[model samples]
Target: MTGPVPENGQHHDLVARLVAVLRATGGTAAVCTACHAVIPTVDGVGLTLFTTHARFVLGATGPLIEQIEDLQISLDQGPCLHAVHHRAPVLVDDLTPTDPRWPAFASHARRRGVAAMFAFPVLLDDHPVAVLDLCRTTAGPLSDTDRRQATVYAAAAAVLLRADADADHGDGAVVSASAARTQQATGMVMHQAGIDAAAALHRLRTHAFDQNQDLAQVVTDVLTRRLRFDPTPG
Candidate 1:
């Protein structure tokens, strides 16, 4: 299992193995736990599901993974978000402070001992429905076989999450209170500044970092009408 799977049959077998485990476990949390056990190269895993309205952190292997997800949520950038946007895997063998893709996220994650990251988009009906994120304490590329397994795990996660969504009418992916508030503030900023979602979120992140305030507090200020984003001049 150190190199490429070498054959399509082997790859399908890997997917079946994980899909079985996912079905037996019957939940996103169990999917993450199982993925962590099987993917030895990764130190932590997080799963995020995106619906029409919002995204949810449906599962995480531990606190480190949860913290990484939170950082991405606040900054509005990271491998997980990128994977979802590109509908493909985003693999970083080393996360360094100078990485231009996500400078702030890379710096903070490196300080937290996350030396590597891999994010795979989970697809259902050819549409990306979620991202499966892996974090490693050591900086190195994943073995080809391990990377294949990660892809399979992400496929299995999509199955489990889709089932969960169907059962609860998608309400199971409850946006956290902070996340809901952040979304509200982002909408407010969008209306005020005549900008899109991405720009509004970036503005919120900038204000939070500049003021040395927590993102939630910044959102609170926006929601309370204490802070506003004025439309920039053309």
Candidate 2:
């Protein structure tokens, strides 16, 4: 995720450009853009757990974004979930006073001090895939200008994600379903050779769990000859 810092002049120039875009469009402070992977480049495929391509966060909205993600994983429902499932934007203007559409989410969000939320789907070839979220602390519908700005950001995110995905796939950096199946088949072959799938899975999981590393990284190690597994004697 780390990269060379931009020269002061270049840094200021970029910030100024963003500020000009936001100001001309009347956007509020606290704007941020994020891609799915830790590294924004296309080569970091399968390195992170981003289901969506990229997202934009604004103002005090960052904390709420984490809270909402946790809530969705806990309560198993919410706008982000819908955005991912149905591939469409989910907008909630007010969290207080209850909204019939998301009774559980509203109650939980209100308790957590969230007032408004918006999620826009990122699309590829007219098919929605990822989500871009925007939020506000104060309770009220998003102003027209804010909505426009959010949409613009979402559009930019969609373009970036599409380009990244395309590049990764084209360069063989991204894993495909067939590749995953092949890897699984290879693993099964090793297991059938008496490697022990459960034990191996456990060992891998244990190593990753103890190291606080990603499961995918563990798998990569196994595939890349960096790690080896030996079955215990029964």
Candidate 3:
């Protein structure tokens, strides 16, 4: 929440390097690559872009990070999505099953070995455009320095995204096929359960977590009628 000026000697150097990377590569992938190289405290970093009609992961430092991003996308809840919605950082010092804020995300991320998570929203023109997510394998709060550096990295991501927009990169308009399917499945669940959109999505996410199945798989089953949102699930 506090903007630490990146002018300290080391942070200043990092900012320069990030700016160079953005100029050279000009996308979220480049931002992730730079973060992975410069920051060694966290297990991995991920970038998710949110546009008016779509949301997608632009890049990640590792496969697990990619999975985490996808999981959040599927469930429509997590630090990243929360950060975007609130337009502020979401920092979970330690992930626990008892955390009620994101019940499904916390349990699944713990199962996947994520013990701490931080999400910083990237804003452009005063609107959130993306989230920079950092996942740690150990449970603990990030050092103040690490938090500041992460904030700097998020700022750089915003710059790169703005550049991509100016160049008509079309990344913002890119919708994931999985996301489309999830939307359809949510609609079906709404109809079947006689619930509103929010309740239907929550029901779908709850079923996925209860079955220990991937949300994508759950959505597939729903679409194919293998799973139903009846009072007693079939």
Candidate 3 lDDT tens digits, 22-98: 67764455777677666788998888888765566677777678678878877688999999889999999889966
lDDT of 1 by residue, 12-70 (tens): 67677777766676556576777788787789988877766555566777768866876
Q: How many backbone clashes does candidate 3 have?
A: 0
The estimated TM-scores of all candidates read 0.70, 0.47, 0.69
What's the lDDT of the predicted structure labeled candidate 1?
0.78
TM-score computed on alpha carbons, candidate 1: 0.70
Summed backbone clashes in each candidate are 0, 0, 0
Name model 1 segments beyond 4 Å from true.
1-10, 172-234
Measured over all alpha carbons after superposition, the RMSD of each candidate to the real structure, in angstroms, is 5.6, 13.2, 6.2
Give residue 113's lDDT in candidate 1 (0 to 100): 89
Model 3 — TM-score against the truth?
Answer: 0.69
Per-residue alpha-carbon lDDT of model 2 for 100-199, expressed as tens digits? 7667877876776768767666565776544555555566665554554444455444444454466664311233332353245347435644664434
* Residue 177 lDDT in candidate 1: 45
